[model samples]
Target: MSSVIGKRCVCRVEVSRVEWNFLHPWQRTPQSKSTGTAFVIEGKKLLTNAHVVRSATDIRIRPHGSTRRYPAEVLYFGPDFDLALLKIKGEQEEIDFFAENGKDHICSSGKEPDAKRKKFLHGLQFATDLPALHESVHVVGFPTGGNTICVTEGVVSRIDFLGFSKSLMLTIQIDAAINPGNSGGPALNSEGLVTGVAFSTKSHKKNQPLSNIGYLIPIDIVKNFLGRCQENPSTYALSPIIPYRFHSLENKSLRLAHAVPDTVEGVLLTSVCDSMKGFLAKGDVLTGIDDRKVSNDGQVQLRGDETIQHGYLLRGKFLDEQVRFSVFRNGEHVISSPAVLRYIPTICPRWESVDYFPDYLILGTVVLLPMSTYLQCQKGCGTRLSASTTNWCQKWPHEWEGKEGLVVLTEMFSHEVCFGYNRPYWRFVETYNDIPIKCLAHLRDLWEESMEQAKESDDRNGDSNSAKTFSFVRLGLEHSDDIVFEVRAAIQAQADILKQQHIPCPSNITQSNPRYKS
Candidate 1:
């Protein structure tokens, strides 16, 4: 175990800084330094945790024992997976190090390396197959900025779903002691091959200290992620199709006026990729796939397998594969075949000067910040009415009842629309244009209509100098000051209506609510 600890590990990474505000409203204090790690598989590219470089103003990667540091930048990121790819300049020393110790080299050197090539290969190669559960493992990285690479020894505790990232095969649970500085570091099997990237840990509660429950991003997923990056550097940042955010819509009793029982029961196709068009369109209620009947809740029941989400059944397959969807469109049950797309549509996390808010456009802009049981654990606090305003765009806990209300997490600023409205974190939006808002597709239509009206108004007024504005009607506890009664009554009325309609709602809300069952 000691021999497997640090000898074969070489992670390409940097030191990063993150800032969180404890006091002082709306102000991010200063930079807090944290260790970051990245490693290459198959010489394609690098991998690290999304949190490792989150909101980082500076990033500098240096080899374990080297004084020289190289500037690195983000290549791609899947927030849902908590993984990011980094692009760095290949210097002589770095290339030599990678050639010697990293995964099997795929890059062509201008000149051939003779058997006696003097490359200073520093990293260990990744193993081809996954290690069995309970296999001994070692982790290596510069945690807390020490003189040399720090190493921790443990064993794989679990190797199924981690229920964190939406990407398939993205996580691994280990008893290895992962610390704040150990994030993005490489986890190694006893054979000295890289296995996973260390990411998160369970927190200690009162009277209950946490144990070795560290999680890792499996090397296999990273390998797949890197391959995509290397193949297309320009679009490497784009993610594959897999959604982290999805709400159940198997309402049999609350069917639309003409929607049939089958249409009412299957999962509602609430949203699709913003960039990925033609593959999936919003409002297409998926009733079945590949000839299998999708349960009303958007799940596909297999012969003896556990009922799984239809999307999960489509996991790991490529775009262009013919997927038959039995969808209920406009009260008609139709089989729609959407083309497979490699690129996932997403709102770039980094804000851009644009007209559409990403998720809100797909789901309705009217939403409540998720106040589920899972959200509360992250914020380390209980639900308070005013907390949403202060923590807008900042991480906080939220609580809620079943289908409850829609919560807004992020909003894109497009033109002058929604200009005066402050983005509130964890705030719930109940309606749009007086209609009960449920998801992203509903919001997109509302926004489009508003834009059209604004355009018409401007045209009729012949005012070229003035820009028309659209109002984003939102109902929530945040506006409890002005529309307190209205929001409360709406909540109660909605609850009663849903109960009367026999619509199934979530039993409890938590950050873990949307997470996949491990």
Candidate 2:
């Protein structure tokens, strides 16, 4: 292990967090503390994992051997790629962290004069190329069980590739002992330069036999992530995908069914975004990308003795970049001009969504929440949703419309207004007062309007005791019978339920729920 790389480049990240309490919608979890590793990079920014700063209220940085900590802010928290960029909050102020006489290299022990905290003398440089398989590497971090920085050794075991922007997920698997608090640390080569960033370990579950197997986000992914950050200089990084799905044409019968000649070998385009409907179609044989010829198994030559999936060629490219794709359709080999792949919507948006707090609305005593990947993982949640609706979009994911989302009737307070209706804990709400429900906000608006209309209807009836008896609002549900509640009684039940439950708000929404657009 190189002493200079660990001591000078890496810094310990301390995070103070106050997370949302999903179980109790209106409340927040207690403040908690966590630590991870970050290293200096070009532009005076620190690089680390997004999970390190998740739900963070305050973040501080302590350079190796320094007792003082400096406050910092996240520049880009890319949860999609599990990476983040940060800088000292007061960098605009007198940034004496680096002395005036400091050297340009990151490993330099540039001495500071009268400074309370040590300055980064230099930023770590990325390797010009990826380390070959079996190359020994050093993992540096301030892992748990110790306060000082710890260095571990490992060998690069594998590097796999596939997909468009998602190809960036193809990380370097290493036989390293990566543990809690080691996240975002750099994997250094013999020259002590950064080759990869430590991100994950295989099978983190207890009782699992997996050990000595960790993964590093390689330089290519780091560079690609940094490149996408330029699209929005002040926000978190997100993976912008190209709407393309290619399947292997490995089988003889399958290739023959697609009308491919015996001499031709390439992958088949199984699905693409609606924007590509006229240009490409399902079952189209994809022959090449630019000048590179694709193989039957969807692989393409990277160079002599090296091969990668054809989509890897497009990994570094931006979403707006037009790619020259060659395909065989209707018995003709066509060389098409550049086509800028479009953004497509997903059916179950909750899966891998980056929301710090999810959007939810309370209708009287009923809780209306949107379906998401995160919601599906909690408390046997996968079964909470009706399989008929959840499976429809999943089975034919391409059929899911843009801006479409599910609004589930996930909860109900133990009030007399909803006493007769079955719990239907995770059933979806399809309509309100006979009007279709679009999203959580839309459902809220409908309920509010229905209450107002019910008030108007009561005014026309003029103070009759019978009129107070039953003006109703109906909520339709999937996999359950309609829930009928007296309008005025249900609205009053909301305040009663909140008071009894110690909830301050009727809903947990800060923004109009974001829908993945077409």
Give the top-scoring candidate (TM-score).
2
Q: Count the backbone clashes (under 3 Å) in each candidate.
A: 34, 4
Model 2 clash pairs? Answer: 97-119, 350-372, 350-373, 351-373
lDDT of 2 by residue, 1-518 (tens): 44443366688999999876665556777899999999888787889987888778999888776666778888776655678888888854217543321323323355432221232245677887888888999999989899998999999987766221222456788898998899999999997778999987767576573789888888887887787777666443345454567889889898778778988888888777666666667778888888999899988886566677666666545556677778888899988877765444454553233543466777788877766623444555545364645464443344744235667776788998788676546777787877887667788777788778877877888889776646677889886788888888888998899899887788765452243212
lDDT of 1 at 470: 31
Residue 176, model 2: lDDT of: 85
lDDT of 1 by residue, 1-518 (tens): 25421333345455556443321112354766666676553343456787787767677766554555666777665454577776555576456545444233223764543332223143346667655667888887666646467888888876654355434443567887787767888888876678887887866676453787888877766666555555555553334455322345644454553355542556665555443345346666666766788776656663354454566445533433456666677777787656453533222122111111212221222222232212323453336533652343221112122222244433222222223445444434555556665543454455456555655766776755455343433443334321222222333443554454343441212231111111
Those runs of model 1 whose alpha carbons end farther than 4 Å from true positions after fitting are 1-29, 40-45, 89-123, 165-169, 204-209, 237-518
TM-score for each model: 0.52, 0.87
Score candidate 2 by lDDT: 0.72
Return the top candidate by lDDT. Answer: 2
Error of model 1, residue 501, in angstroms: 49
After best superposition, candidate 1 residue 395: deviation in angstroms?
Answer: 22
